[model samples]
Target chain A: MGGGKEARRGDVLLSGEGLVRRYDDATVVDVDSIEVRTGEVLAVLGPNGAGKSTLLRLLAALEAPEDGRLLYRGRAVGRDDPELRRTVAAVLQRPYLWRGTVAGNVEFALKARRLSASERRERVRQALQMVDIVDLADVPVDTLSGGEAQRVALARALAVEPEILFLDEPTADLDVSVRRRLLGDLERIVRHAAPAIVLVTHDPGEAFALADRVVVMEGGRIVQAGTPAEIFESPATEFVASFTGAEFMLNGTVSKVDEGTMTVRLESGASLEAAGSAEPGARVRVGYRPEDVVVSLPQSSSTSARNRFDTTVAHLHPRGGLVRLRLEADSLSLEAVITRHAMEELGLQVGTSVVAQVKATALHVFPA
Target chain B: MDVLVDAARQALALLLSGDPYLWGIIARSLQVSGSAVALGLLVGIPIGTWLGLTRFPGRGIAVALVNTGLALPPVVVGLFVYLLLSRQGPFGELGWLYTTSAMIAAQVVLAAPYVAAITLAAVQAVPPELRLQARALGAGRWQALLLHLREARLSLMAAVAAGFGAVISEVGAVMMVGGNVHGETRVITTAIVLETRRGQFATAMALGLILLAIAFAANAFITRVQQAAPRRRRPLTS
Candidate 1:
């Protein structure tokens, strides 16, 4: 991952400025500027109704923005511009396959361009082989499973060898295993081809897995845009933090500020030190992931975590091999995740008192 | 009972013997209805596709008008065509009255609406995203539209079947404009009516059976064509 973003990113292929889309009385997408660079995967991550798909549509020129201009290689382009259309392709959430055999579906895009029959056949062969579905070429689309159908959709898009690809939750409806396989295949294919890709998804894990740059969107606007590590480590807002797996939130008021460090007094009378400066008496929120909170026996002071809380376990939620413990202290509650092996060793159950520790760097502080 | 038995026996004899008069009426019926449906397809597919796939200010009214045509009674259409082809009407100078051309014109009016309405329904039935997908894949406007039509092709065949069904079986329109002239404009439906009125029950029964067989054969052919692609799946050797 060293210098991955700068090393892999190529020249800007497409850009949008002052894009806005409104449906009737409500604006569904509003973005000031966005760029898509060659050989880079850009993920638009957000919750449902966040207009991420709408933004993709705008950038892809599938739907013209009500107010904005799209530049493809420094030239303004319209949704109906054949030049723009020839270089771009999109695979939607649902496959929307034509009523035909697999090979026919793949050949359709090629046929649209009025390509010769030989070239179409060759490209169709290559695309199906790329998706590893060449054997099913002659099978009708209706008999394909969902995963297979999605592969055919991908193959159809790939057949034209587009310069840009837009994927709108390509694996949203798939099962976990199927999703993983498709994601793996997609990663390999996209990396090999190195086309500028705009992937719209709600799953942060997917963004992390594929994106070099992540743009977190909310409320029809982009809230933050940065490298995936930058987004995961220093989210700019509570929504971003929580959406990226920082579920534990505590509201507090700053009590002391010194040397880029501040101590915040929690509502439960617990004071915690975090690495950020704020005016004393300023209200703020502290957020952290469950895995960042360490649990230990009361007498064990072997860890160097800056803040420690003695709390009793209120509930235990087991997720696969990991267990999530809801710990309650005096008038305060927080969650911590520990391994099943650790829980067994500690003999921790509801009402068992233990110490929870978090390092100052683990806490993300934002104005409430 | 005896009259019915005699008519059925004589009807089979007339059919097997291929009576030239009866065969001529059958041939005329096919010619008029076939030409009308072909004309209907020429006129209806584009209008229906345009209405179905695009949005414009009067689209609703246009659609409503097409829907209204779907329910238009054959006799009403016949009377409308009758007045137009009559000697004193607007198109009277054409002198097409009591001729096969007039009958074809009347059936065209009847069949075009069926083609249009069904084509509209078929186009609308395709998933809207399909056209968008085609465009996203670099299909030109008309190419996307052709793709949409191809996707709705099976249903379009039904449109053709419906149009043919409406005109071929219809007696009113053809009879009014055709005038059922002997050796000239008489078609299956009209000839059956004439024979029945003249107490030529055997000939009428024979014509009736031929009409049913033609309708069945046409629909069956369309159904077969519609089902051919969907049911075919080559077995994968790998």
Candidate 2:
């Protein structure tokens, strides 16, 4: 889907309307409305105890909602409908294999579909091959490694060719390289098969890398849902921004209104420009990604293309290939990320006066 | 001390000799306990599986009732069965009183709850994710249960073993219901009691030793099955 309107036309593959689930006095899931498209991957991102798993359980029909309805393909299905039952498959966070050969585990799903023996065998073979575990087909399911087992689980779900796939933290426990590889394979599978995917995870990078659209959840409610680029460029809420790694939030007051753009002056006395229109003298919050802020040596030439400010480095911490610098300018603090090589070349140190350049378009402004 | 040693030696001799009387006692014990365990498996496994997987208003009450039955005294059950099968009691016209069938009925009652409670624990021990995964994979409710039972085969077998162990060693119910007939209903436990009361300490000790061996064998076989069951492994693919 190229536009927002087209994105909503993916045919309401799954929807939760006013869904609520309660355990004793605690409400675990309280989504007002959320929908998954027919052939798109929607990543549900949240921290621990944020009800991500609870929402997945609700959608999978493993747990019933206390209130509201779950519509699948425009029909209400509440864990008892055989038609809806046949259309969905879920791969949970901790994958479990039945007592049998790996081939047998994959065949179990196909058999449920009433496929003939020959057809079942072929489907099982294809599923195994898809997960790159064909060689382990005859091996006992209990003998495979963690990553291998997860692949087998996926293969089992894929064998049935489900219309929807719910994956709960599929690669949470996997190592970095293995997780990356599995994620890559999953991306290919979803793209080619075009099954609606609801992937729940706490990793922002994973969400950004795989999701066609990202839904940020907190306290059992969906705070925001949009394309990855849309969320990155402009988060609808502060929670969404922070969850997506928008770390520095500057509280400022609107100083001047220029057409659709607003110039806001922060407590640090540094004025920043943003593209959102707001009434003059209104309170606002401005945020920018750390990498979007560029650091240069003092006395650098100001260019028309950049919003430059003179600042002193408050702190420098090296992380991986980049060094994150906390800079102070007129009592306002901003975080900037620069390469270690650049830091060494600039001989940047704490208390050193420097020029921080931020692009106006990169700055996201929201009503306080 | 010498008399005790002599009785022990005589008991061992009788066992090694394969006395027909002793074999008869063993056969009767097997007949009663085997049938009871089979019936227990039939009724207990499904109930246990259901109780483990589904939630209902009285589920906790049912579980507690089963656990309470675990400590139910054999003598108390025997008394209840005796009263039920006695003349002037319900179904007394069927003449089940003092028969092997009556004894088996008592044993079944005594054993089924043990099986059910153990099986419930076993089935509950299985991760809930496994059931969810099965359902998500498009398996119907029955299919999910069957798969879960297969995954938990070893534990279920242990439940059956526990039930057999409980019934086989029980004396009061078998004695009260079967009347401990000389050639028919004389199970090991009942025969041991009878022989001891009749001053046949040697025969009593022999049957007691055989009973212990059978219990040990049953437990060993169950343990072997549990060990043979597959270890948890990650799926081959996700």
Candidate 3:
């Protein structure tokens, strides 16, 4: 890797080589090398405690890795450089606003640079308008609700007009509707501003919706990094499939193997048959997407699907046009997403009996 | 109860009569305590901020020592300062003992730790993210410290108030080091002690009333600050 000759200016805004961060005696983030290109949104997607946020911090230069070289503009620099800080801005998860009016919080970064008062005011107004929160400018930060506060925080970051924007789980704490709305707002802002961005999130949908590229991290290492389509559809690792909620991981053991299909007994003792290579008496893990699982009433119909589990509807919630159901079958828990119209037709309710139907090809089985 | 009433009456009378002697004692008390707390702030705020924000080897021990210093016995501090300035001690040539400087030094020992301890707790109470956010938004180390201090202003003000209150109301250290000499080392606390020992209960009560007023004022000030959303600042009118 002749980094000096190969590195091109304006293509990559920031890069890290051999980054390592540890906490509680565990190396929570250990990336060999990563880069953020200009005018692209790179989303770091991972499950809870997967060190996604730590990677964001390292990339943003907020935390100096114990062992690593952080390079800016293809040149290594001190981690705490004021110039570097000035060029980058971040909106952390559950961001805290300074004790002042919304406008005050927005102007803080500007003030550090000693911008003219008129310039600061103009930028603050523009940022607030960008987030559609101009009316909230005079409101004190503490008085704003969670969604409104998050918008204010975004406005504060945008007001800096930074070269790079780092957003760590920006919408994770928001309500579903609010998160969607904010994501839409962010897409619009990103299009207009076109600054390099590094977004850390736990949801694959969010990464697909808002980022140009997705990097999947697990157990402190980058398992895969590629276009969102590649990550969501053709994930390089099963951990990415399980983490993105694209698939549900359930513990199961093989009951028997006959012909080409393997009968695996789930935690609830219910058996499922899938086209897999696992042998008899072998412990295996099952993975399938909620959208692939069909929720049908018991005795509604008989289908050629090889796997059907007798389940009781434990809970259900609306997810846009679909309804997410949490079904329980004794000792096993499963999730299924079906259309609202189907939900109304089936008349599914909590404690109602339903058999979850899945095609044999949909289940991806792996040795436990 | 009657003795208390009579003492209050005498306190009011002395205050109303424009007595210079009592005023001198009060002024001297303020001078000594104010100087001690000022020095304490100068030395303690930085140390406390460092302790609160940074992680280093033996930090726990340093923090434990600071908290312990919060409850430092004034008499013990006074004895230590006294020995440091005593004729028999090593640095005795400077001769600070039996003087107001000696009282101020001892009180500084008592007050600086209170300032430091409170500041440490206050800085730690502040959200670590605040400092991180500040630094991320182009603030240098000193700027980040200032920003964090502004966020924890309530705790800092409380620390100052506690320091002042601790020193102004303390009697043991100043008595041991300053010797309560009239017109020189005698502050309100020592005067009150002297008056009470001589059975001049009214004078002692009058001095005690002034000291109580100071304490009450300090408490009221802190209460007002704490009650305010963050700090005493007019809304930006631009």
* Model 2 bad stretches (over 4 Å): A1-9, A298-301, A341-353, B221-238
Better of 1 and 3 by lDDT: 1
**Candidates sorted by DockQ, descending order?**
2, 1, 3
**Number of the top candidate by DockQ?**
2
Q: Write the per-residue lDDT of candidate 3 for residues B1-238, one digit (tens) a residue.
A: 9988998898889988978989999999999999999999988898898899999999999988888888889899989999999999876898988999999899988898889988998899889998888877777877777888998888899889989998999999999999999999999998998998998888888899999999998888778867776332333211
Rank candidates by TM-score, best first: 1, 2, 3
Estimate the Cα RMSD of every predicted model relative to the unseen true structure: 3.9, 3.7, 6.4
Over B178-226, each residue of candidate 2 has an lDDT whose tens digit, in order, gives 9998997889998998899999999998999889998998899787876
Model 3 residue A22 CA deviation (Å) reads 2.0
The chain A TM-scores for the candidates, taken one by one, are: 0.93, 0.90, 0.75
Model 1 alpha-carbon drift over 4 Å, by segment: A1-9, A298-300, A341-348, B86-95, B216-238
Interface quality of candidate 1 as DockQ: 0.46
lDDT by residue for model 1 (B131-224), tens: 9888888888889889999999888988988899889999988888889999999999999999999999999999998889878987897778
Note the DockQ of each predicted structure.
0.46, 0.55, 0.25
Worst 10-residue stretch by lDDT in candidate 3 chain A? A1-10
Worst 10 residues of 3 chain B by lDDT: B229-238
